[model samples]
Target: MQIPEVGEPAPGFTLPGTTVRDGARTDGEYALAAEIGRTVVLAFYPGDATPVCTAQLCSYQEELDDFGDLGAVVWGISPQALDSHAAFAHGSSLTFPLLSDPAGDVVRAYGLVAPGIGLRRSVFVIGPDGVVRWRHVGLVGLRFPKAATIRAQVEQLVA
Candidate 1:
């Protein structure tokens, strides 16, 4: 499957997402259509709590304010269940939504599923009009764009 490219509508998804911030935990559905007028950073990782995945997500957390300041909503997607997602969110102190795609439907739609293993570490920067503006699908699970790079993409998309 081909990854959704710039100028293409992103594959819509309404997945279960949870976020805990400042001791308040909120759980709800995260739908792409709902973010139509905002920049959305859709990051698809392999799983929760793995060393590399943990580092990648924590890096996002460290720069969460930068993403928000750029007027972007970042959601971490993985094929893990909501239970795993909840645990990961709580343990990692991730303020951004972590979406659950246990059925792999959404990842498949985005053409992000890995060849023989789990989901490829992928990031899609969607613009305010709901079209994909930039994308990075890592060949391996461990490599991914840093928070600064992702913010730059969001800025470019909105510019």
Candidate 2:
């Protein structure tokens, strides 16, 4: 599957997701279409609680305010269960939603899954017009875009 290209409409998704708040887990469904008027940061990782994924998400958590300041709504996507996402969010103190894509439909939509491993780490920045403005799909899943880079793209795209 081809990853959605820049200037293209981001693939729409509505998945069950989980987030942490005040040490409590909140579960809900998130839809890409629901965020049409705001910048959206979609971070797709392999699973919950892995070392590099942990670092990536924790960095996002630590700098989430910057994303908000840029008018971006951030979310994490993985092929785990909502329960797993809830646990991970609680453990990592993630303030944003971590979407569960157990069927990998969203992963396939974003062209993120590979043969051996599951989801190759990927990031997509969708502008307020619902078009993809920036994207990075990791070749080896070792690294992803930092929050600052995402914020910059959000500012540039939404400006």
Candidate 3:
């Protein structure tokens, strides 16, 4: 399946999952439809506890405030189980939500799932109106975008 493109409506999803560090089941269903009125940053990492994954997650944590100030909600999705996600988030002190997509249902919908591996490193920025505004698939040595890059894109949507 082709990845959703910019200006395309993000595929709606209500995935069952647990929180990053809290180990608590989030009450409300997580759906792109519900996030329509706000900017949503959906990031998919490989697995939990790996070196690259660790740095990627921690970077998102460190930039939480900046993302919040831009009025964007950030989320990380992986194929790990709830317990593992919880441990990783707790150890990293990540502020955003980390959800489990063990079945790869959500990941597949976003076209982030690799044939053999779980999820490809990718990030999609959804506009307030629910259209995908930006996306980046796997890079050899993927690095999270700098704060300025994030701010610029978000400002365009929020403006």
Reference-based lDDT, residue 150, model 1: 89
Best by the lDDT measure = 2
When 1 and 2 are scored with lDDT, the better candidate is 2
Candidate 2: C-alpha lDDT:
0.90
Compose the digit string of candidate 2's lDDT tens values, residues 1-159: 789999999999899988889987888989999999999999999989999999999999988898888788999999989888888888888889999899999999888888898889999999998999999999999988898888888889756
Model 2: ten consecutive residues of lowest lDDT: 150-159
Which 10-residue window of candidate 3 scores lowest in summed lDDT?
20-29
Instruction: Give me the displacement of residue 107 in model 2, in angstroms.
Output: 0.4
- TM-score of model 3 vs. true structure: 0.87
Worst 10 residues of 1 by lDDT: 17-26
Which candidate should be chosen as best, given TM-score against the real structure?
Answer: 2
TM-score, candidate 2, is 0.97
Cα error, residue 96 of model 2, in Å, equals 0.4
TM-score of each: 0.95, 0.97, 0.87
Q: How far is candidate 2 from the true structure (C-alpha RMSD, Å)?
A: 0.9
The lDDT values for all models are 0.87, 0.90, 0.77
Give a tens-digit lDDT track for model 3, residues 1-159: 679999898887876445544544342346778787899988888888889889887877787888888899988888887778777777777757777788888888988767666678888899998888998878543565654566678878867
